[model samples]
Target: MSEANECLFCKIIAGEIPSNTVYEDDSTIAFSDIHPKAKVHVLIVPKKHYANVAELAEQDSHELSHMVGIAKSIADKEFHGAYRLIFNTGEDAGQSVFHVHAHVLTGEVMAE
Candidate 1:
């Protein structure tokens, strides 16, 4: 596991910060978004701290696959056909938190 001093997701995983968790496992967690953009908005993040997808290249391949698999399950079980998976990487892309995460959204299309 990565060092915890500067990671928000790590804190969320350890229950240091409050969150609405939807799914959990040894390596990951899926939770509802506090500032939801849709009827079914969720965030899926790895247990380890990585700043973004690019930083996640060092992690094992299995974790990536499992994250995507979780995303699909969330979509199928929650969205039922109308949803989008978004990963904003930098300031220009709207990423506020400095951690790797997948945003699963549905119910309405977001504005451009």
Candidate 2:
């Protein structure tokens, strides 16, 4: 996937599209999910885009760690120590956006 040309999350990170930003650093940006699956649902994406975890792992695994750290930090503050970090790698896995992201799902209760 050409992230700059087509990825929605890339646009969100670039400020090409607005997002409810929660956390940001040089490497990543964390924001509230527009269609939240949980009370504290958020998505953490890297400024440098990769199509998915495998692509990211092959290209630059450090970016993956950066994204995970951001997710953990967000969960720490928002979930008060409980959350799930999810990565849907492909369409079959429910990854609608090709750009890699970590979905932080939290709150008192979440759907299964």
Candidate 1 deviant stretches above 4 angstroms: 1-3, 107-112
Q: List the residue pairs that clash in candidate 1.
A: none
Q: If candidate 2 were superposed on the true structure by all CA atoms, what would the RMSD be?
A: 1.9
Q: Give the alpha-carbon lDDT of every model.
A: 0.83, 0.84
For residues 78-106, write the lDDT of model 2, one tens digit per residue: 77867888999999999999988889998
What is the per-residue lDDT of model 1 for residues 1-112, given as tens digits with 9 covering 90 to 100?
5456658778898899999999999999999998888888999998987888777756666787788889888878866756688888997889988888989886665566
For model 2, the superposed segments whose C-alpha errors exceed 4 Å read 1-3
> Candidate 1: TM-score?
0.85
In candidate 2, what residue range of length 10 has the lowest lDDT sum? 1-10
TM-score winner: 2
Residue 81 in candidate 1 has what lDDT? 58
Clash pairs, candidate 2, are none
